[model samples]
Target chain A: MKRNPAALFFVAAVVAAMLFVGFHSARRAGSGNSDSLDVTGKPAPDFTLDSLDGKKIQLSSYKGQAVLLNFWATWCGPCKIEMPWFVDLQKEYGPQGLQIVGVAMDDASKDEIAKFVKEMGVNYTILLGKEAVGQEYGGVNVLPTTFFIDRDGKIVAREFGLQSRSLFVDNIKKSLSQGRAVQAQK
Target chain B: MQLMPRSKSQLAGVLLLFAASALAQSPGKKSPSVTLAPIDPVSVTRGKGAEVSLHFRVAAGFHINSNTPKSEFLIPTALKMDAPTDVALTKTSYPAGKDMTFPFAPDEPLNVYTGDFTISMMVRPLHTVQPGKYAVHGDLKYQACDNAACYPPKHLPVEFEVKVLKNATPAGRNPAQSPHAHR
Candidate 1:
């Protein structure tokens, strides 16, 4: 039996179309993975705001130290739950050059936030952030977006929701170790 | 393009392939569903304060954090009240929400709402108040997500009517009186 050239052409066309579709979808998936907020090896965004107290806190001011910048609001539930862990993290790492900064995105008055902060016994620096500033850093599209910045100001990791204490610690350790390795190389 | 017709089997084969692809990308495929609950109406006596709660119901496997959301990318719920100048608006407190992590996106975790949540606000009357049904509107913006993907920011408008009594003291206080005043 003789082979039909037209049938062979049709088969080849179908094969090529399927391969193209598969390749395109895979490429899209890969790009999405890399586009999360500058999680690793990028300079953290700098911000300055007054704490619940009258004092001022600046992200860049904490040079030579690792900083955990946590964006939250008084009305967020998970934020309240994470407050104690944040305080604990500060106590455990403050001496080791770790700064934990809390930025509040509340629509309520500052006094209301202060009351909540006082009730929670939050000792870290708390700053007030507007929606514009929140959008500048990405914005509180969701609650409890946490960024881990290293001593060199590079954002090492980021968590968009309520993050576990262990996950936070592990990421910080990894970033610190990486920093040391880079220093040794230098 | 050809006047020559193919066999019935060939047409069926082509139709079958198209059907398979359609099934793969069909809307009925496993997707997380989200729904919002209406805000309840609250009433207060004259010259007094009335507290009412805003409700949100999230589907399973999806959750949103309370007001103090962690990331700028995360959706933070908000309440906007439309009231007369005579009505005082107090701050609302959100109950603590669950800490939710998108399992597939192991790197980024957002504190979000998964199930039902509420926001309670204290509405007060001014010294000189009128009697009527005042509407309190709340725009709760939130980003919902399941284990794999996050939905776009949802603006849920929750409104309730509260009756103000005669000779009632306005319950809403001046936002300037608080430290976290947004105005």
Candidate 2:
């Protein structure tokens, strides 16, 4: 039997094509898992807003620490429900390089937010959220949307709507562990 | 080139694969913000008016903007109905909204409806219409919002049937039974 070089070349080309298509499809699937507002493993959008105490706070300033960026409002019932958990988490993890940043999307004045914070006994940094900033963060359509960012400012998880305290703690733990791993590598 | 035809076919195959994958990756349909309960059928006589109440319950932790929102950009809750030529929709009255004050702007108050609320619709059947069963189809347009953020506006469909009876006059009937008595 004569060896057909052309047939061998055709088989090799078909195999190469199939492998290329499989790799491309896998990459597309991986990227598609990320939400437009909360793209995991991507750099988080940075914004500067004034705190309830009249101090300017920049999201990027906490680059080396894990950040729990929560968008909430004073009137949101679920937000009220989750705020106490956030307060406890802040107290428990603040010393461990966890920075919780609360962005108030309220139509009320800053004084009202400050009063609410005082009433809730929130110890973390609370910043005023602007419509533009909300749009930048993928149009925070629900109250209490939270983003967990690692030490490198990359979003590790994006939670929409009200979540359980344990879910939040788990994501925070993951982000914090990733931060430590990166630090160890450095 | 000798390979031109083969390369062209290969390119076509790749494009077809890309189109199929793109379609598969499209987002799924979103669920409605408000759910409507099945309205009980109402009975009315020809040449008389009646009131029908449709109940709507918003999703938990969400409120639909009132008929009159504080800002123009905010979408106000509204109802529209489709009726036969013989049926006339007189008016629709939304329930009163609760005044809510948020921390973002304490001075500016927002009007919103939370939980379960009813919208009363006044419908009248023309005298020229014959007695029969008719279905009224309508939809409620509303933008659901929580204290922290607002969602895109959604439309919820509503439907109910009304049985029309032949108008009859009863002598010495009780005032409560008289259709014109209320009017």
Candidate 3:
């Protein structure tokens, strides 16, 4: 039996290359879901729930508009801090096809949340979210889990904590600009 | 039976490779050594003027958030006090926190605490108290994670002793020691 040094080098190179490709491809494939829910570059999971105004709203109904869906509770300090920014966003971009939705996660009765909403003067479309919706949006383990959806109804970005206005704006402007292109194509 | 020559070194090499990979994927390999300070068990004096204070010293770059966690999924730090039937415990308070985020995943960030944060428990002296060493125990529940992965929450049990004097100096806490004293 003869051992060839060149053959050993070639085999080693091939093995290293395979390992790199396998590791990176697996990592990329794993990014579509966060905490076992579809939240990135996928059609968001649709749910029908009662809006604060007593109207039944299904996520699939807002297919042509960019949606900023936020999960928050009144008692959460971080959520309270970001509520004003969301209200401002609704006023500024409501006409631009940007819809900001707040899904209250508090266990308090609707009357309690309505009182707080009135005190805070929140102007966006707020609704109540059950534990099921939290599971659908990747187990929103934190208050103020907000998702940015493109006009075509695909979630593009998500923020897990208090929303930063600048960061939120950047994501919104990018999505809106891209949405215009998407609309022009249709 | 014919004995064929086999390379013992090759078999040993294969075994070593398997062992190395298994160790790399073990659960305990990702955490640093966390040491909890000793729980000093003591009893308070039985008198109308008895008071107690519990103290904790978190290691650098480690902190536990207030009872109301800054975000969901993150465990909030807690303080539980056990004393005689006559003693009264004061409500606890936590200092403010700087907004910060941790990497729950490569692309997702979770709000959490960083750096040194402190929690304190105060017990007021009822006019009538028993003269004994009052023992109190509690844990600092926190999960330490950097910009990368988060380790499981660790409950660091911490305790302290408080002595009651006939005319205690109001137990004025050290400015450098108390959580409120820091700011």
Candidate 4:
């Protein structure tokens, strides 16, 4: 029996292509959950959590305003450094449709977080962060990770670790400008 | 019937292709997230002080915070050594960190270490100590972070053996060269 060399080569090439495609698709499917949440230009994941004052706050309620969502903990050193900056930004940009929300990813008691908030004079809304909510936001593993969302609830940028006050202000300005553009379009 | 040389060559070719693909898919092909490789140990005379160096590597795209954090509250990378009674740790020296600016903090520069770095320590033996082999344990504590997020603080344990020898000459005379001297 004679085997055609051309046929063997074609079969090998097809097998290689199929294997490559299968590997690529498997990798994508494995990371789909986190990728969908963290990808830029996608709508931010919405959740409802109780504020420090026992007010049920829905993320979608602030859709028309630019939002800065910060996931932090009381024990995190970087969180302490940026809490003051958040307070200042809330004061400066609140009138311009900026809403800074802090989700405390802490195991500390509510009184501890409240005391820290009072001491820092945080002017923004503070909510207790749940592990499930953190997972939904693609795992807030780092302390002081922040997401900048535009007025349309689309995440524009994500920041990790301790960020400078100027950087936060710059992001806020960008988000606010995006809000104006979105309003004009509506 | 016996197989022809061409048929044997074809089988060899197919095996070679499979081997290449398997090598490509192996996890060892990827760089490790973090690693601490122990360098050659140091030898010292009793009551004399000496230094030991260790190589530390952090994967690309990730950085560990520096010993001197930008803020007071941030967790700083620290190296702690557990020395035996005979072996005393005089001091530990850390290399200067690279100043990096990320998009999160474009203006303020943070001190961090990426890629490969070295941590060295000065150790001295007590005067009453005898010549022997001693194991020194150490822990490197750090918090790793990338552009997207930060991970919890991790403590990596490392150890290296030190061989202490008795002085051959008088107390004031020059000591002999170490046989295990690192290049």
Candidate 5:
């Protein structure tokens, strides 16, 4: 066998770099609250947050229905793109036990958020978000992070950033199909 | 020599591996970011004002709202300076924001700044201020977005050094002694 020390050394260096990258990627994917974090098929973390109308709203209260928990901010432009779609979808799917809840993750005042919601004509429930609550779901580092929860309260899927309206419809359908059908409470 | 082709092939293999590694590691493209350029040292005579311009650059494929956005709901990019007692930022002039339509709101034009932009500020040191170098610090608050998504508002720390020169002639200079100069 011909001894090629340079070639062997180069191959070893490349392999080491590849291993390092793989390890780094795995660590990143396990920690962040965005696309890297995989919370699918896991129980949705429940929390109590203040609704827009000075009332305490709890996530677990809406049981036996498919839930779309959206983390959005008033300053998020892409989030605005999805707002009307959400309103329409809520009207279309409300009878089918689908509930869309928007968690306003912003530093804006409650009144400001409510005003924006009113201007957008949002029909869904909006809850003021806290950093601790965001931490529970890994960390809402990105705007418009959405979780699709089934009737069993398991997160069917998680989407980060603005996605197409059709994609949202598909996830909603999947979520509604798995959860038990129960009459929605006002 | 027979080994020349072999050496070239080996080099090509290494280059390909490095290029592939870079491609896999580049994820910042998805994130929006803005950066401030290092400010040039500004020298102002005590009791006089000097114009200092701050240059900021936005990452490719991103834009930040101007000081006056069309919508009140939007967070405008603004600079807030905290200067020493001796120093004051009297005025900050923002460049007029260009009206641009994005895929998100195509019908409604929004005022925004993209790529390189500058914010000019007037820096003045009181006449009583000692002639020396002072660091003026501030923060730039901006909300950035791309064609598809928007990021939360971020504050970038900004700083610049101002050299205050003596407003009057040095006392060391012997005044031309006119016999009745004071009279």
Candidate 6:
């Protein structure tokens, strides 16, 4: 088959242009969707908000322990599904310096949030999330946005939406392995 | 130079492929949306009540809670309208929700609406209302969710026109009384 040189060159150029467009479009989409993942291996944002018990809870206070900071809302059903897993993980890893923290990002009343937490039998800390706090950690576009922070307060890994329990366990183990643990206060 | 028919056809095919590729990558990045269908102009006689139906479409791959969600935590879809003083919004009827379970919670069934749904409301005009076209503006508040995740509550603006006829509709008209019955 005799292929015209001009036609062949034109087709190749067109293909190259299309590939460039696709690549750049994908990169932009990736950055927007992976805002939380971009913070991996970086210091987790520290925030202080009132817990269900009315006491101010500071993120940096748990610096000595590995932290699993989760941003969730009352309306998020997926968040509800992961609650039991988080509860079980807390019990399994608490003695090993793993501290899980939940931040409620809904506009519900404090009492209502407290009630939900109690009903879930969540053993870890539950804090009322504020817009300012959420903005510090990529604006939390998805519910159940979880970040695994090492004992040194740096985020080792993060997950969006609902993921397998095994993934959570893996991140927890990785978080616990890194960073030095500080002595507990008397 | 004018392109041959074969070259032109080839170019068109290439453009179509590009469009398809662009659309394929947008769903993940684009936010979910619920759009209101354009409503036809409605005519109602003064002093008479009229039923208005509003049609809404949820984006594909997403569902919104029904007017009555099973859980208190879920934000149910609701319509709030500010009818003109002369015209009152009497009643709102919501469609029954579909009981479907999502992968996130297989055991618990949620009351949700997907695809196209209609919300009907009653608009009653007072007897004193003058004949004119009135714009009824409102908003439909809903929280959307997909199989994997849920989005926060959003309010989509709702608007429709109601033309009130100048002639008043007679109320409580009894069928003509028979004169023979009186005898």
Best by DockQ: 6
Off by over 4 Å in 6: A1-37, A180-186, B1-27, B169-183
Tell me, by TM-score, which candidate is best: 6
DockQ of predictions, in order shown: 0.05, 0.08, 0.05, 0.09, 0.23, 0.28
- Give a tens-digit lDDT track for model 6, residues A40-134: 87898888899888899989999788999988888988889899999999999999989999999998999888888888899999999998887
Model 5 CA deviation exceeding 4 Å by range: A1-36, A179-186, B1-30, B169-183
The alpha-carbon lDDT assigned to residue A55 of candidate 1 equals: 76
Which ten contiguous residues of candidate 5 chain B have the minimum total lDDT? B22-31
Interface RMSD of each: 8.7, 10.1, 9.2, 9.0, 6.4, 5.0
- Give the higher-TM-score candidate: 1 or 2: 2
Give the distance in Å from residue B91's predicted Cα in candidate 1 to where it truly belongs: 23
Error of 1 at A185 (Å): 13
TM-score of each candidate structure, all chains considered together: 0.49, 0.51, 0.50, 0.55, 0.81, 0.82
Q: Looking at model 3 chain B, which ten-residue stretch has the lowest summed lDDT?
A: B24-33
**Tens-digit per-residue lDDT, B99-133, candidate 3:** 54433232333344454444555565565654455
Candidate 4's error at A75, in angstroms? 9.7
* Model 3 docking grade: incorrect
DockQ class, candidate 6? acceptable
lDDT of 1 by residue, A83-174 (tens): 99889988988887788888887766788888888888998888987676566565445556777887778878777656567988987675
Local lDDT at A73 for model 3: 72
lDDT at position A31, candidate 5: 17
Tell me the tens digit of each residue's lDDT in model 4 across A9-73. 86577558756754664454321012224546678889999899989999999988999999887
Candidate 2 lDDT tens digits, B1-183: 566667657656766665554434332112226888888887877787789999999866557778987654456799989987798877799989888875433677778888898999877888888888999998999866554444446679989998887865446879887667679
lDDT on C-alpha atoms for all candidate structures:
0.65, 0.75, 0.60, 0.75, 0.83, 0.83
- Count steric clashes of candidate 5: 1
Residues A1-186 of candidate 3: C-alpha lDDT, one tens digit per residue: 545465556545655665565455444432111233546787788998888779999987887788989887764545666788888988898898888888987767788888888888998888888889888877765555778988877888887555458989887776665555476866
By DockQ rank, best first, the candidates go 6, 5, 4, 2, 3, 1
| Model 5 agreement with the true structure over A33-147: per-residue lDDT tens digits | 2433467888899999999998999999887889999999998887898999999999999899899999999999999999999999999999999988888887777777889
